[model samples]
Target: MTDPWNPADPGVLRLPSGRLVRGRGLRRPLDGSAPTPSYALYLLGRQPPPVTWEFRWIRWPDFRLPADRAEARAALTEAWERAAGERVEIACGGGRGRTGTALACLAVLDGVPAEEAVDFVRSHYDRRAVETPWQKRYVRRF
Candidate 1:
């Protein structure tokens, strides 16, 4: 298992179309001992400054899609569009669960069979990803 406190180095998940997206978890300092991380972070771009990719936040703890589905869709669409130009990142508190769910959705968008996405995330990213039973169900819905 990953340390959870320390996220893995980001990577590109190449879609069948040759586009790419990065995935990870943005978490509050685990040292604080808070119940959960503040929010999920999904960013689109390469390293360093002047990155062209966009960024979005999904509130954690609750784990609902953004209040504005359109915004969420727009974010994903932009990520999809920019996937060829830059790396896109999807993250949650533990680099699992919410992050995994979002990554699975990206896999769906990438043309991976939706049913296989959860397992893909588990095998590739972190085994603990998509932690909750409902979270696994959510990935299927994507």
Candidate 2:
């Protein structure tokens, strides 16, 4: 049987360097009701089979990166480095605040002005992204 999620949907982003990543909300269901898979499983590749690209997750909540900035930096760095070889995704519960924050950080590593990352995401991803005040603050810091 064919799946309906369509992994190649617009929610996915491909940077200039061919890195593909998708932002998602953890609270949301995978097939509409099932539990989310393991972070490693989600990032290593798509579900089922045919692993198209590698992935990794950054477990940011509504408005916070990992308490350990070191871990957060490491994860982001690894994602940045792996961008050259495979797709890297950073997701959260709303795909807006947290995901957008992570994407903005990626943009910073990609040379986007730290000041403009939030606007960049607003223009490209969703105007509603970076919704929370803390989310905006996080973008500036990144």
Candidate 3:
């Protein structure tokens, strides 16, 4: 199955491997017209509100990294793999810092070089993604 999110949809980021994942901010109002993701990873300080779709919550504070690095990796890898067929999404409170970092990491899993993943996400997803220095470093080391 080659089901994928529409490239023109809000927050959609097409990875180098041709996998599509949407990145969004939970703090903002979700677009009612937008398609819902089959699976989503929420990088947030606390558990997100229950949604109709399946989701995993990673304890990632705003402007910070995941509390459990190993778990984050596993969850990110799951999201990346699922993106091959499912409509995967990566999200956070503001969607630029934590969300961007996760997207960059996903890029790495999708065959993008770790060093260039941040740039790739910024160019295609959000101009101000991967907000902090540590976030960029994390992507580089991912």
Candidate 4:
């Protein structure tokens, strides 16, 4: 199904099940015209700013790895489920490493093989995604 928000942004990733979840850089300005997400997952080492949308923050360091695996998994799973019917977005500082890692995990949850999730994310979302080796390894483990 086409996303009601039509989040045609730079980091949107459309999963195999047609779930549309956008991945973006938190540093970038949110487009006022863009549709607000019903749920937003923020991957950051620091606390995220307060927002009107239902949100979750995963203690993920930029260019590094997620601080908590179990929590990250739960959050990503929740994000995956929400993406099926709601406007769900995953974002981080630069929106490449942590964001892409989360997106890859969501792809894995959506039935993409864990081994191929990172490549799938890169090919469909961003070529420079999943920046570090550990991040790619994390996707494989996801």
Candidate 5:
């Protein structure tokens, strides 16, 4: 079995239930010092570059919602489930919008109220997470 992510890792966010999911920006260089994720979810409008580890890609354009809401749900749910016993990472080009939105949804799955999930992520992950008003609304309705 894979080991869990270090809560102190640069992009790791510890959910209220103690699951650790790392959210990152594809625009930034990955910190080489951090351990790689056992599984990852990449949110992008187009196919992303392949990696050595297992991964999934959702056609989620930058600053926008996922193209297939159902696919996003399944992918995020899988990511959250794996994070309990593996290092799972969720990433988008800029990481704040799509990544943050997905993280909030995972928060909801982890038992955070949908209305409060966004705040929970912003407080523990990035201060500017869930970038747009619609994204915040999405979290609320998740």
Candidate 6:
């Protein structure tokens, strides 16, 4: 699996429409050379620190589930739309669980079958992705 935070890597996923989106971990310092995202989705249990880039937060606890399903869907759909025309990123504390889950959802939005999205992200991004069963189920339901 590629290091999601690596500037050279970006851990990008190319959608069926040819749009690219990146997934990353907020816990690690971002690589200075990485391309700056025009928009970002930060999935965390609490509010994120202020940032200059346009961003949205989904109240998602680590190794757990999102606080609100409807909100998560709306935010993820927005992120997916933005990724079609701009650099977009989805991130979480460790970049594995929540980030992977979000990325899998994006994969589903990208035309991947929902049932396959989790495995798709795990193989393409990180082996340890989607750390919990519910996260996997969430991807399927996305």
RMSD of each: 9.1, 7.0, 1.1, 1.9, 0.9, 4.2
| TM, every model | 0.63, 0.68, 0.96, 0.94, 0.97, 0.91
| Pairs that clash in candidate 1 | 22-88, 22-89, 24-91, 25-92, 97-130
Q: Which window of 10 residues has the lowest lDDT sum in candidate 6?
A: 1-10
State residue 50's C-alpha deviation in candidate 6, in Å. 1.2
Model 2, 109-133: lDDT tens digits are: 8878889988877776767777777
Q: Clashes in each model (backbone N, CA, C under 3 Å)?
A: 5, 2, 0, 0, 0, 0
Q: Candidate 5 at residue 18, lDDT?
A: 91
lDDT by residue (tens digit), candidate 3, 1-142: 5468999988999997789999999988777887888999999998899999999999999998899999999999999999999999899999899999999999999889998999999999999999999999999998
Candidate 4 lDDT over 1-142, as tens digits, reads 3344464666778899988888888899788877778899999999999999899999987888879899989999999988888889899988888998899999999999999999999998899889999999989987
Candidate 6 lDDT score relative to the true structure: 0.85
Comparison by lDDT, 1 against 4, better one = 4
Model 5 regions lying over 4 Å from their true place: none
Tens-digit lDDT string for candidate 6 (52-89): 88999999999998999999999999988877677788
**Model 4 vs. true fold: TM:** 0.94
Worst ten-residue run, lDDT, model 5? 28-37
Error of 4 at 129 (Å): 0.6
Number of the candidate with higher TM-score, 2 or 4: 4
lDDT (C-alpha, whole model) for all candidates: 0.55, 0.59, 0.93, 0.88, 0.91, 0.85
Candidate 1 regions exceeding 4 Å error are 1-12, 28-54, 62-70
TM-score of 1: 0.63
- Looking at candidate 3, what is the lDDT of residue 118? 92
Ranking by TM-score: 5, 3, 4, 6, 2, 1
Candidate scoring better on lDDT of 2 and 5: 5
Clash count, predicted structure 2:
2
